[model samples]
Target: MAHVVSKSEMRHVSVEELRQMASDCRESIWAQAQAIGREPKIYLHWTAGHYGQFWDDYHVQIDEDGEIYVYGELDEILSHTWRRNTGAIGVTLLCGYQANTSDLGPEPPTAAQIEGMARAIEALADGLWLTICKEFVATHGECADNETNDWCHEDYGPRTTCERWDLEYLQTDESPAFNPWAEDGSRGGDVLRGKANWYHNQRG
Candidate 1:
């Protein structure tokens, strides 16, 4: 079977390919989970804050260079978000979404990577029967939009500043960008939930 990836060049990757990448990064992810002492069930996607840097803090990880990784014990909620870690799953994209310069890095995520991201979300959403939730969306990352100053102190739910990717751009048929994830959470959350719902509806 061939992998027909979308024009995310549109950046990102295939979920199956991303899963294989996760297998490669398993050991480190296990080590991170051991140190954090958390368990999760909900899926949250993220990217490394720096370019060319991949970490096991999240269950699954992807790099700007288009490398994919999976951390062990992903089903167990880890400590990415304090209050939100109770029943959550976390995935990280290697490049920063809102951060340009040293954040997004010289190379941003590829179309395949983003496509994989959506697929991965759909897979998990179907697996867990997750409802529509903006657990991954956060305005902590760098953005020209001063829409909301600061994370509003968990009042919105989380204080993490790494949710820089605008996934909304990927949800539409419009051309996807290498640096397209959003911090609004709502924008990107729709894509995540939409895909998940579609998968669920299809299974029926």
Candidate 2:
């Protein structure tokens, strides 16, 4: 029988510690997923809360200061995304409260938070043998975009009803590029994936 991990075992950690934790738990997570006959995928999100806020729905969270909080095990299911919890590792950035289409609100995603999430992605992808692509790694907005992805159960996203547009427009210092896949190419899942890929190569 598999050892049961408590859902309440949330812990605060730094970015480096998060990478170490992912490495330490790699084999167990992979074995558990195989035991359950499921493929692991990563789903990124924003809490829509204050910078220091934390949520129990997501397995991992990165705060405005790049502090990481682990809420549950990688293979443990959490109610972060609608209809996509099973075999899904949910990672969220705590920011975007009171955000709108034209505004990112006062507590927008910070550079540290974005880089932290990218590093977390690199660690998790390395542990899970996942490809940093749309099929394996996606944002809540992408999952909500029914037109582009089959992950959505309803018509909602920045391109649709404009709901669940978490991480739609990231706070970046670079000039953004417009693309058909996202409202802006430099602010979508591609950016995170690109950063994660860069980290992977740099570290390798």
> Residue-wise lDDT of candidate 2 within 140-181, one digit each (tens)?
887777433354387576667777778776756541432325
Task: Note the Cα lDDT for every prediction shown.
Answer: 0.44, 0.75
lDDT tens per residue, model 1, 1-204? 112122232233455554454454445444544455532234444453454454545655555544545554555445554444444566555554454322334445565555555566655544444443443322222221222232323332222343333332332333233232444433444555565556546667
Off by over 4 Å in 2: 1-9, 14-17, 23-38, 146-152, 175-184
| lDDT at residue 45 of model 2 (Cα atoms) | 94
TM-score of each: 0.50, 0.82
Candidate 1: deviation at residue 187, Å? 2.2
Top model number, TM-score:
2
Model 1 error, position 23 (Å): 17
